[model samples]
Target: MIGMGNPRGIAGRPLRVLFLVENAPVPGDRRVWNEALTLAQVGFQVSIVCPKWGYPGFYEERQGIRIYRVPLPSLGGIAGHLVEYLIATPVLFLYTALIFLRDGFDVIHAANPPDFLFTIGRVFKWLGKKFVFDQHDVVPEACASRWSGIRMRLTYAIASWTEHASYRTADIVIVPNESVRRLAVERGGIDPARAFVVRNAIGLAHFRDAQPRAELRRGRRHLVFYAGVIGPDDGLDQLMLAARHIVAKRGRQDIHFAVLGDGDCAPQVKQMSQRLGLGDVVEFTGWVKDDRLIADYLATADVCVVPDPKTPVNDLCSMNKMVEYMAMGKPVVAFDLKEAQETGGGAALYVTADGHAGPEAFGDGILELLSSPGMRESMGRIGRQRFNEFLAWEHQQASLLRAYQTLLGYPSVLVA
Candidate 1:
């Protein structure tokens, strides 16, 4: 059964949707790319506005979606970040206004701000277009993670106010998790009824075609995989600390750990690994462009890990890696959090929140899964089954479309 707001009237016709994303090159981000593709599939004339970076310069209409990549300077650090955002906002505003003037759109969907897309939403509203808030990160929680000065506090205050405006201006706020939806209702002053929870889901079709070629493991005794950003929030050092414990204390030299993906903290993470004398056991493949390697990395592992430290952002957030690992039929071990626990369920071996759940705890978690192949198989089966039944991308599209439809006061379906 479809949930409360199924779109019964809006089928077959190509509905126009303009998606706005920040700091990301189009066709690069999995979540945004998935959203764009899905909307295109369901007869939507989709156009995306994003920054042009890396080799894929400027514009390309990929998979029936129009992309407009505006030129922006890449800057780093707090001051650099401020400049980048400051520059991006006006550029986004100018280009978006042009798009609205040129293409008659049915909807204007923008991803979270600095969650301040309300300014853009206001522009689209003036053009008689609907607005959708695709909430990916909680700006307030992220503020705590990234900044710590009075200036930071002041910036956060402005961001928070803008977040409120975005929520108030939009017809519906689409969140990654229920916790985020509640936060929008509670803090952002959005109506609970209008808030839509669209989970970060894995596209199982990609994994189905992706053959797990385990060359990275290269005849290793046991493979432990960690994929995603190499950032402070990722707790990669914790994973390293656990790897150190496994090698020195547990005397396990047979295991190999592969850390995939890149981020701002790569240099520091690499330094930490070297200092821990984990040079031999640990391997960091920074920012992979190959998709087959990604599948193999997850599929080849005896156990996959999500080592996000316990924080408000983490607790409210659902990591896509967990579901992807499950889709590849791999058991997972993660630090305890409500969303992680709920998503992984009995499919994961959770480390206790007490002090024991450190590097040693992480090591023990891996060892436990390694020791019991049957348990590993059982958890993997549960996870894969869960993904097939509930957490797949197809299951999530209804919520996504419903959020958009609701903003347009159009009917929508909840995926059953």
Candidate 2:
């Protein structure tokens, strides 16, 4: 695969950047939206290519940025992802190729793995476009989550290989956290200078920093909140078990647990919550819009939770909800993953990582935090401070800009 090593004549041209995304729409994705808006604000001509969703037909140019959407086969299950990739990849390449043919782009910023867009990036590279690989998910871990058989095993092997190739091809590789940054250097054989860590952070300015809604917290005895995707990797069952433990062992009926956001395991998680006799206290909100998230849930919560299963992949990757929770200045309780501890620091009450820690320890941790408002407030303070210092989007924006500045100065471009 041909990759962009360094860009020539990329500086001072209002970088004609093409951002390629997998499933989500342009404006809807928080990270991608953040990047697009930031780049546009900084005088770059940004165009996002993604799958068509509920938004208007095909092309749109809103807020001095162009967004191009192509029809993908499906957005549902594994079958849908496969179908979407099968059709979407070709259409994506052709659409991008047309754009390249018409107006040569300065940079091709591709986000992924599923890693489908590497082929497109390779095609563009042959035509002299600079390639930037934004690593989102660890493909091998995702593969391990879904598959157990030989077929999936082979697919996993191929995806892993492709991931490495993406790193080798990229002029600059960006990962969300330092752990993945190390992987890009060690596994991908990329230079340390070429790898960047652009973390997932809350746009602190955008999130409504209102007083925690006492009204929402009033009717409930205690409010326990969990947000983000309910995927297999996210260990929702453990959270349910903790809910059950809270009710059965501790007789803690005063606390109500709200699970927000939907994923593959949503239905089963709901069933498990119900079966655990948390019929009243345990609830699911299922993919609330961002505005609703701020207004209805996060603004009112007493405590936030992120219960990703402790896996090799999770330990290395950072969870954005934890950062979001910190952005809102809410105390958090999560399973003890190394990165969580690093990001959360003393801000979160970490439950043990033992398989059993899912429910019982979660119950204990939440109860401990709930019992001490002073401690919760302190944790929240430290968390918000940490957000400002390290994890906010404004900070990441600098790194993103720097990476581009470096690439844009390739080959005889003065380093002024």
Candidate 3:
């Protein structure tokens, strides 16, 4: 058992931490939730400021952490995103001030997609609070992947500025993987000593002894699964095209694909699935919140696919879905992404596509895995073993706590 004995501040009081999140709500954003729970478990006073995202309350306490929710507008497209950030920036600032005055905090830990939370961190830093920037995505590359032309260029320029600003403002920067840690130092020009790779991982308790339900397969002989956001850059369009190839081009009707999670491009991806005449073969479950239901879906799948295409952003960022698939003891089929390979190691079958012919190769990889149950079983065993040894939250939590230990001036000790 891992021990994080009582963590106290220099003043002999519990170190209070306030997490700033823009993209997703508290608890729904599992990484932030896990971080908060980890700190709270070790006697840190943890609080969160994030969007309500349909949760009713403006403020609530759950599992020993306090959550302050703000109702932010959900906007899309480049211009819409700009307007949304312009609106959200001030609203989040106001909420942060309210939290500061009410509960008080020692550190502001901000997670990014917008990367504009550095503005808040800067403000808090002026008020004698340390700032930790949790870099979730490479904002400039993400912008470039999502849009193009003069507008995209403008967005990319602005994103680059905010990303640099975030790196400069953060007292310590926490990244999801080593790829991003290198970017933080090289691209953002942050000091190497100030950066930490916390990794996107979950505790094994979430997946322990999960049972598959045959009914989740929908009477199909084989089930293929895809989970995580269905964004434009997320390669759902490619998945849809692959589904078309599997059912139409290959004349395979025995395999059914289930897609979980929702995002900005969900409606468009669903429309494309219909347009490609893959309605019977593909099912979209639209963001399953129930852990048991999600577990059942993952457990029932014969082969799991990470359809995130090779993009500037995708190649660098470590996908949470890939790790989740590994945690569930499932074999994966993903594009030949750098970080995917780093996380999957020998556990996943990486597919390479030439030019725009990615969907065909992706489909072939899925079919290859589906055809060989012995290979799938071997890959699954490898994945679970890897998760248990290295990628599990039990291991990653040590890095997280060590980052905090360094930040808070606690005596550094091996966490595991």
Candidate 4:
């Protein structure tokens, strides 16, 4: 007989989950980390299997959750992603099976960019497990945004087919925003009610007491900050161009730009920044993992910019960085994206993308925000207040619990 709160438990026992993510490791991917920890805190036995990225493969325990990191080869370009996915898929399946036996799971919560986990989820489902497809982004659109070639046509077709398959197979579909929920219902052909919208929000504990670091400001009159991935479609080049337009053409040397986070494009963006005469004014802190330090950078900054311009993937995706900047009580400037517009509320200034929303307009928006201290303060206050009231992790936690309860067939969720 299984014990109470045991993963393989008898009736009235607590629930258990196996979370699979391929894009990044747990704890590093804040959303995944928060979800795992939140579930664990609420009495679920949570086990996560993810890639090592470069770290040595090891099993560790953090915040009462078990994590198994599998090593993956570092590669670039389309072929590289494909190879990494191919290798990681089997590793994830193998490790997940081992975890299930060691610490049994009632449900499999899988995150995607590969969208290939549905096959494994299907097998588990055949064995009487429930599946949840956590949609972080639309794979086909994200692929098209990053690469354009005849070789990718087949890849895109396969991704589209797999995306629909993932949706069709899931017991419940979880999305970041309304747009993604609509995509799953309308295009992916899932039932509307079965798809849940749990928007990306900042877990307040991650930045609770973060204070400003004056050195980050670099004795500048205004500081501009950019967080999140530095991928091709992220438009950091556009930001570098804007920085050039500000420092070189506009002759505004008082503004300092801090580019945070990392991706394959960081090297190119750094090179471009140096070539464009932004060497002295622009600082690239590639992928800072310290939440406190990142929060400090956010607190010290005058304004934050979401340089991801209009794109197929970006149009629907809800960016975590945008919400995070707001959570830290910082104002934002971003391209006039529908989801960003909705997420940022009145906290952000929209730069019109007449044609891809060039750097000129972006520079102007930053300059305008920098010039008016009162407007910046007002936006920041509105953002922080709005976050506390609605956009904070608290609201998201309620939605998440409701979704889980509905999916698990519980009458109601019991808070712990």
Candidate 5:
């Protein structure tokens, strides 16, 4: 075991950390941003190297953390993804080297989707730097969910290989949920003692001060909110179908559906909504960055929906939106996914099935929630309580810090 005999680092200097993220940008990627802030609060020098998607500039310092952004092309499809990864890996490596030469980092904390960050981590490990592999998603499963035929098989094989490579290269592994932790141990063959579960939870201060904007309902009697990425695998198309069923079939004109956030499938989703005659009842507010606005939408929401259909990836991965809805004291309607059930507990109503039947069932679940004010209130209370007790970022911080303490060779210190 690597031992420093001190919490900071060898000789009592503050331990420096460099976060390598290829999927998303800093601050925008709430999970990484939350982790960064938590480590910074404990006196660790933190820096992030990520893609410049929504955020501009090459570099910036925010709240004592340094962020280095690389401009990357927004691409799609199997071939595009291959080209994108090939381009991203080397550019990100260059930034990592630059950060090491200038500021220096004791640990290379790499979050994965492409799972290729381990290649860079392996090089740094040779130079005596620690690697913490933060598995954000099951890449192989995600590839399967997004593609089919030869492309799916090829991508899955490559993803599986890279994922295992990442697990083997890491000094410590951090997962978002127990399902992922189990995968890391059993499938990736990592030691159980070295893997940690640090959920993608919201901070306590999140939405603490924002008031509900009733006006956001937009003259409707009830508001149903859905937030996060609108990818094809995310089941947004199913959600639009649900909206059509509610409005056209059930004749429930009293309810309005608000979708916040954008993704690769945003245009397709919008087109479906229009084609289904849901333009009036459904509002697509693409990517609301303002915290207060998001808080307002959630606070005013009668019910929040997680339309992620049952798939290998969706079943195993935790959804951040579900927890966020719970944090706002809003009951959720989600598919009966394993991690979703674990995360939601009694806070959500799970709809079973997939395809056309799934959306119909999902619509029925929404209607059931809308029909009973008392049930919604009770479920909301339960969700909020659960969030406060076990699912908040405050609770997850201890595990994250413990993982770092173990990796850096310091005795575990209580976080808060």
Candidate 6:
């Protein structure tokens, strides 16, 4: 079967899930929305609580799931982030209190980048609610990647302590990759059996019957596509530098770069591109939310690039972009990191991870793949096959179901 919907019933009654996320809005956050749908399909009365990242409304219902949104504060430096989380905590707690007062949840599924939510889980756990810590990012490493010196050390400690608390509070730890699962067990001292690896995968249905938009190529010999947050760890600087190397240094005026998505570094990246004299050679479409635009970008590009320079957080973390690229039957050029290599397989052209050399190699890789349409097509075919076989969200959902089954202690007869 290409896909599996969550079964209609569990042990006796419909399972109730309270999903919580600190970052990103519902529906916009594809992973959370997909998980909510998967759980809802299985007869779980799903309710999501998330920060409204400038989205209108404090509450709404979409596709049979109840979504509650809270105000998201403007992002700033380290202190600003702290203020944001501190502010969000009370709002979430108040919202959660209301939910429990009206209709309590059976399972509290909390996704983390900010890991202190375990305290709320612990509080709910006292009232017999099961806590599931969905480890989205290793906060310690994420902090380390974002900063350095004493500030880095302090952030690492805070992240480490909170992550440990989260793990200790969790009845089951849901991780996106084996590396993360291993981290939970080894570093967080979580029980190995209690940790589950639910990979980040594309919802295959979204790409079904999707057609190429040749117009997105924009009169260029080759279109290089990149989409996602342009943070420090994201290596947008490296990407811009590589584009400069290709266009200005190597004199490849025929190729055009379409850098989609945005983050804190977006303005700087745009400025850098201009300073590099990549005039008219690069396009920065900041934070594209339009599905058709994103689809067109993915469709028309000859190759997609995963420009995350190798870091502790990035190395272990599986990229949504790489998987999305493959799902779209597009080949990739990425830094050779463990999980990235594991995720893309033969679908990506990897550059050795040696800082400056990596971007140079990445540029070369784009050129190399662009030169051969047959190779690009072949790699895309390989990627799409691999995605269908093992990497699609449909396949990944089985593990999610099984994880819930285990956490709920449902009998074999209750397994979907």
TM-score of 1: 0.90
Residue 89 of candidate 6: its Cα lDDT?
A: 75
Candidate 6: 10-residue stretch with minimal lDDT: 1-10
Instruction: Order the candidate numbers by lDDT, best to worst.
Output: 5, 3, 6, 4, 1, 2
* Alpha-carbon runs more than 4 Å astray in model 3: 1-6, 413-416
What is candidate 6's lDDT per residue for 300-344, written digit by digit as tens?
Answer: 888899989988899998898888899889999999889999998
Model 3 TM-score is 0.97
Instruction: Tell me which of candidates 3 and 5 scores higher on lDDT.
Output: 5
Name the lDDT value of residue 212 in candidate 5.
Answer: 73
lDDT of 4 by residue, 1-416 (tens): 11112233468566888999888888788778777766776678898888787455578888788888888665567888789788878888898788778777889999987798998899899889999999998989877877678856867897899998999889999899999999999998888878888888876565878888878878887789999888877899899988888887789989899988888888999999889878889998887877889889888999999989888888887889988999988989999888999898899999986664478899989999998899999999988887888777767876676667667765452434
| lDDT per residue as tens, model 1, 47-107 | 9998886536667788889899988776656687678888888888888878777875678
Model 2: colliding residue pairs: 242-359
The Cα local distance difference test for each model comes to: 0.80, 0.79, 0.88, 0.84, 0.90, 0.85
Q: RMSD for each model, in Å, please?
A: 3.2, 4.2, 1.6, 3.1, 2.2, 2.5
lDDT of 4: 0.84
Clashes (N, CA, C under 3 Å) per candidate:
8, 1, 0, 1, 0, 0
lDDT of 5 at 268: 93
Give the runs in model 4 whose Cα sits over 4 Å from its true position: 1-13, 54-57, 149-152, 413-416
For residues 1-416, what per-residue lDDT tens digits would candidate 5 score against the true structure? 12223447677788999999988888989999999998888788999999898876988999999999999766778888889999999998999998899989899999987798899999999999999999999999999998899989999999999999999999999999999999999999999989999999998779867677878998999999999998867889989989998998899999999999898899999999999999988999998889888998988899999999999899998999999999999999999999999999999999996666899899999999999999999999999999999999988988888888778667754332
Candidate 5 Cα errors over 4 Å, as ranges = 1-6, 414-416
Task: Choose 2 or 6, whichever is better by TM-score.
Answer: 6
Residue 346 CA error for candidate 1 (Å)?
Answer: 1.1
